[model samples]
Target chain A: MTALSSPATPWKPSVLRLGLHRAALEIKLFNRDVLSLVLVLFFPILMLSLFGTVFGDEPVFGADPSGQGGITPAHYYLPGMLALSTILSGFQNLSSYVATERFNGTVKRLAGTPLPAASYFLGKTGQTLYLIVAQTALLLLAARFLFNVPMPDEPGQWALVAGLMVLSTAAWATVAIAFTALPKSAQSASTLAVLPVLLLSFTSGVYFPFSQLPDWLQSVTNFFPLRWTAGAFRSVFLPPQFAAAEPGGSYGVGTAFVVLAVWVVAGAVLARLAFKWPPQK
Target chain B: MRTPAPGSAADAITVRDLRKTYRLPKGGTLAAVDGLDLAIGAGETYALLGPNGAGKSTTIEILEGHRRADSGDIRVLGTPPWKAAPAFRARIGIVLQEATDSGELRVSEALGSLARCFPAPRPVAEVIAAVGLDGKESVRISTLSGGQRRRLDVALGIIGNPEVLFLDEPTTGFDPAARRQFWELIRSLGEGGTTIVLTTHYLDEAEQLADRIGVINQGRLIAEGTPADIGGPELRIPRVRWRDAAGHHEETTASPAALIRDISDGGRREPLDLAVVRPSLEDIYLQLIDSNRQEPALTGARP
Candidate 1:
């Protein structure tokens, strides 16, 4: 009989499926976290506008200087902004978030429960994906409409953008989980998480342009994801001629993809090894 | 709610020679839990009472699988929690001693989600009501008062209808009314034959809720017994006091009655202030904790 019973039956967890239960809870919590909600959802769009119009209508550095292909300042900053958004949401935000959870005993509570260990991570993955999707969509809309920053016209270009965003998000989020062990405590999490992102932004052509930075700086930043995250997106957003401005004379999209994929794997392995759930004695 | 507490013959939990030690900063080692042994009858309500760092929380966490004991044999429902399968976890519940809550989820949302993890969970509304959070169901956890959040913690713990529940300082932030209600809930759960393991600072709570109480101090079980008997008959000895011409006098003895008769000369020499005082559980617990304080050298329990 399909009749609704007064008291609930033994919870048929078999029907809920693994990770989904945890994902739902995680999403609900994030939905109401005003600080993180605003930062991830609107911060990118805000950044897009705040910096989008800075060098208005000018032929940005390393783009097609002749103006034959109108790669304006917005075009230059758009990819960097996307990369910055990825770093903010995936790496910095997640590192401090996990640290706070560990320090405050959220992980301890989950650890003691019957909940599958994977569900907690799956929940984190779910939260990160939600943030990444929202941030990317918001930034794209703001760039496209608010700043009139033209998006990639071709489906192939958009597909590649989607691909890079996914890889970067996965890599950064996993690495954030692994990175939680670095700080002495939660109070230092934000400081430590933001330091690298800020430094990488300035040195890795995020706040600046990849082609404009000294060759040595470009070579050094290549080891990190921000340089490639920005480069990968710039290839899609800017015209083919802008590839000339790259250090490798191309976005090195192939290497960028490989590096991010490696980071995803490495981050996962390291996180598995380094993840601290129980409150440190 | 469950099969008459699963036959009182089997212990719901047992720990033998449990030990957990941590290296202190700048050198030296601290034995958080050392050579501790414990057992709880299948349907018993047991409270582990101690001071802030007396290792009561550590012991409970080890049982809950939140921390691993360095060396020992521990069984909760016939399985070691650290190596226990999901089925084993499903049988137990834990309320960790923490201030953290599901950040912004409504009380109902968090409870509802956690309830889905168990095989036989109490209804969401029922658990909420039991914890005195009926009206606050839709309220965000981040906004709940400290007492309310603690109630939510208790709610999440029992939502699963666990056969064995571990509550670490379960009523830490509860107001007097809330604490009383929480005690009633625990009593009802105990009456249902559910085995409960609790760690708390309040001796009255232990007396009110626990069928048996253990006083842990300096990483060892210093004393264990029922509310009336813990700390041994020696510690429970009554003190007879009187004010007379000489001065105020207090004498502790096994037989306060005979002592009173001898001192008062069969009521002829008795003063208005003559009285017999029996030490309460709280008094015994404090004496045990104070006398059993661990030295920096990491010595064992005081002789």
Candidate 2:
């Protein structure tokens, strides 16, 4: 008979260590999936560069003709682009990847392992963080060099941007995990993620200034995290005079932070309640 | 780390009154497993044979800790598998029916990464060689053939050095030569003292590898015994045949030797074209399943 033999040496595993190993593999796979990488990392940059060139030299119709045009449409569009990229990294990409893993029995195999479910969750979310950081860096560098958008000059502004990036990514990633339960297959999951994110982007000022939209429509975006993400980025990146383009015309930095914090707390709770480790049949 | 002392429990697996039911789309529930009982000794190979929707996979999944039973007690490796304790998982392995769908990883990379999950994993190179994928170690999983992917799944299952291995239809995609090779691998694993619980439709596979066979139908264990005894004492029945001037003649009897002698009783030294035949395992298995399905007593016994 085969006895239940233990290992000769004792080794204890923590969530962090196990998650790091899983995250390492996940990051490697992400690096190999050229299509996913291009979508998450380069799609936003490509769109920003294309649109930046188209609008950089043209003057906005509403701005004073004699004011030396303090900010071009490209400068106005950079914050929104960053916000869209964050959504793509955290929500769209993550939901599709998770759904595929579940559909293909990868999630089932992992669940059978000795690793904790928390480790798997943390590992995938960590990969999301890595992607978002890379996407943000590439986008910012592109905007600075290709469009001559100024870098955040103050230390406090840099801190705010860093904080916003972390909070928004974490919040959207949690919601993405929760939303994955709704899709029955990987293909449907990808399509599901795209439609809502695209719609949210249009309404959340990802392609245009929020103040330019109607009053009722502006009030509608107040409920979504994407709007706050865009607002937060604009507060950090755009010139102070550009505050007139945002709702309330003062760059409500405090509201941006508070609304995002609410999303983080609420999203974490919802995801915890809705997420299923093995998925349903 | 704690080691289980030798001979603490002779049985590696024990189950009592297991039951599971799934709700159908039309709001009625179908019982997938009902009142099933099984006990397999340590170091013994048990093959669970059943037809489709016969609850074979559900029973194995319950034992593998991948699914929960509606009501039952199942002890594997001295603990209820449903607890899913990591310590318990480290001592058990499973090869699921579907091949693992890891497309992007190379063979070596997949093994290396999964090895970290266990406290003491077998060497990656050794496991690769064991499953006959030595030269294909660098090949991407997407590029592997169906048979090769199944081998990788087996490799992952054994890499943890588990005592109890549960294989759910592990040879579905294997070609003839590959199937024979896999049987050799399984025999070696059993010889090394792993308690194997297997589910397959191949009766020959069961006859070749299992110490005992359990045939289930409609959530009930219809028959259980050694391969020879599972078909009942009628297994000894043999058909005696011969060709004569009149025609060919055949007769089934429990004593084929006596019947043959009687046929040559007229002082004839030999009988022309004489032969005796015994029923194969496949024939007996089909009869058992067919008889069980025809029994009206087995219906409406869901729980």
Give one digit per residue, the lDDT tens place, for model 1 in A1-281.
Answer: 43466254433234336587676667776776787776665776676676755666565545344645555666668888888888888898788888888787777777666776677788778878888888888888877877677777789988898899889988998899989988887889878988888888898777776778887877898888888888888888877777777886888889899999999999999998898554445
Candidate 1's DockQ: 0.45
Off by over 4 Å in 2: A1-12, A58-62, A278-280, B1-8, B242-250, B265-273, B298-303
Off by over 4 Å in 1: A1-16, A58-68, A277-280, B1-9, B287-303
Best by DockQ: 2
Q: In angstroms, give how far residue A184 of model 1 lies from its true place.
A: 3.0
For model 2, residues B50-151, the per-residue Cα lDDT tens digits are: 899999999999998888889988889778888467878888888989954679999999888878888888899999988899899999999999988998
In model 1, the fraction of reference contacts reproduced equals: 0.63
Which candidate achieves the best lDDT against the true structure? Answer: 2
A45-108 in candidate 2: lDDT tens per residue? 8888878777664546237668654676667788888889878988899888887887888888
Instruction: Name the lDDT value of residue A121 in candidate 2.
Output: 84
Binned by DockQ into CAPRI classes (incorrect, acceptable, medium, high), candidate 2 is: medium
